[model samples]
Target: MRSALMLGSATLCAAISPAAFADDVLDNPFFKDSSTQVMARNFYLNRDFHNNGPNTQSYREEWAQGFIATFTSGFTPGTLGLGIDAIGLYGMKLDSSSDRIGTGLLPSSGRHTPGVDKAEDDYSRVAAAVKLKLSKTVLKYGEMTLNLPVYSTGDSRLLPETTEGFYLSSNEIDNLRIDVAHLTSLSTYAQSGHNAGGMTRADVYGATYNFTPALTGALYASDVEDLWKKKYAGLSWVKPIDDTQAFSADFRFYNQKSTGAERGGDIDSNSFSFKTAYSYGAHKLTLAYQAITGKGGYVFYTDGGNTNYLANYVQYAEFTREDERSWQARYDFNFAGLGVPGLNVFARYLRGDNITLANGSTGQTEWERDLEAAYTVQSGPLKDLTFRVRQATYRNSFSGDLDDVRFITQYPINL
Candidate 1:
């Protein structure tokens, strides 16, 4: 979607509905129910490498400020409604230097390439989408953010990744929803262009069904042109034992195989993960086990939006490798029960083993530990302001050792 097209369409609508002829479309539900929001985010990232060498930078650190604004217009009144959505992103460097630059908070001079050692001072990007609705189905074309099990966009950085394509969603079935999309290009969080790895076409389809209010299932598949085909299946169930106690189980599986000329190489892997959680009044405990088997490790478009949904894909490590296995244990607590509302904390640990190194070395292992605390303002002009801090320690002979820390602050404004 283009802003110029949106403006032209508005003018056309106004001209067609001369006040004497009919009500102005601009005054109709379309513009009346529209909404706009902006988010201000301050982020600082520091990762200290345990071992740094000639080819590797000792540590990557960056501080940045970002603003994300979104505008969503309500559909016009008609059998086939029309609407538009737009997103604007701006990032400014607060503190960054050539020696400490690969932190993802700012674009690297080489576009996220390590050891390039230069970061842009500031960047801005904008995108929009035009949408149509008929009955319970909606179709949109232009830039968008997607989150399906098979193909998802990453948002763990200064700006979210976006895709240029056509997306469709149908909710004709009572308890089911269907989504399909055909995308041609992608823009990474650190890049402003949509030319990612010569992406010719990526088609995806997904369906979700809610058997009951407490149980749901989903199936999704995606095929990246000349790369690979991936399929995902998931199930979730929750049981409430009492007013403040509950148990939940989640299962996820992925099967991937190379196709066409296999531009991404001959990948043949099956990954599965299972997670269970128990929640009490103000405490929650979670455990998960994930494994990968077949020819190689899990593969994704690293430069575009490669956020693997596997359970072991943590802040610093993805415990995914040929014939690898990993498990996690986590605990969370809410301070509200102790008279401190809007505060929470969590700690997690994950370990992986049964992996082969680059030289075919066997019995390799890796582990990571993470702790985080977050709080949101409860009242006053600072209401809804949030602050979060995370610390992590990762160790792996194959990937080296590191201590990572992140501090983030965010505030949202509605207009």
Candidate 2:
């Protein structure tokens, strides 16, 4: 069944593309229904290691500010509409020393080896894309931010990882969407050590189907050159029981194998995860389970700052290892039901066991607990401002224990 679904999705993706232009492309308008937005993000990260390792930094801290400005122009009024989009990205280091550097807030000084022992001053970059639209299908070229199931960009730090690629998206079919892309290079958002000049190539194809108003399913396949080939599929369903009660279920799976010359070493892995949640008024509860079964562990491409769509991808531990099983229990509360609007809190605990290591050990175990509180301004001059505080404690049989804390503030401006 999964193979059939994947084949169908691949066929659909191959069949979708943008329409060709009938007249000169210059006829399209430059700005018809254009919009622009700018966001200012302030980030602070701190980590203290309980057991100090000689090669690893015991204490890491960094403070940085980021500015992200995006401008998107509407398609020109014609049968073949043309548009342009541009982005300006900049990151400034506020405070960091040589001893306390590896926090990823600023670029490191090393060129060949990616490290954060010596921090750099600041870094900035720019990107632009040309887009052509015909009916409900659009074709884009140049730098882009991808959010596909198989290969997506990570934006958890001062700057988001961007890629140079060609993308095609079509929504002409009712309740179904198709996406295809070929990315040639990637720019790590980091200014210094790691993200300097490493660019890789990858290709992806995916399709998403909306079965109903509350049910959606997706299939995706990707190949990162000679590195790995990954196949992913997922289902999400939300059901409203009453006005203030609801239930939701999310399931995801990944199958990865080495391809071509196998540059990143051999990998043969399969991973699956599921999460179910129930919401009642301001209270919510969630339960999740995830496992990996293969000779190799679950791995994805990231330059130290990236995210995967797995169920157990927490702040500290991803819970992904060779022959591993994990479970999580979580709870959330919204202050609006308690007469305090715009406030929310959530906490979760995860445990993993039966981790198979390269040394042939199979009884390793680990756990992590995370708590976060966040609030957004309801109204007044500070409307739309958001503040968040996150804390996590992680312990494992293989590595040192860590206590992590993060404070973040974000404000958006439209012009």
lDDT top scorer: 1
TM-score between candidate 2 and the true structure: 0.89
Relative to the true structure, candidate 1 reaches a TM of 0.91
Across 331-405, the per-residue lDDT of candidate 2 in tens digits comes to 999999988899999999999999998888888999999999999999998788999999999999986999999
Compared with the true structure, what per-residue lDDT tens digits does model 1 show for residues 1-415?
Answer: 6999999999998877686355565568788889999999999999999765557777889999999999999899999999999999899999988889888788877545555558998988899999999999999999978788877888778887888899999999999999999989888766767754466788999999999999999999998888888999999999999999999999999898988988877789999999999999999999999999887777775324554777888888889887889999999999999999999999999999999654778788999999999999999998999999999999986766999999999999988
Worst ten in a row by lDDT for model 2: 17-26
176, model 1: CA deviation in Å?
A: 0.5
* Candidate 2 wrongly placed segments (more than 4 Å): 1-30, 111-117, 192-199, 303-307
- Give the least accurate 10-residue stretch of model 1, judged by summed lDDT: 301-310
- Clashing residue pairs, backbone N/CA/C < 3 A, model 1: none
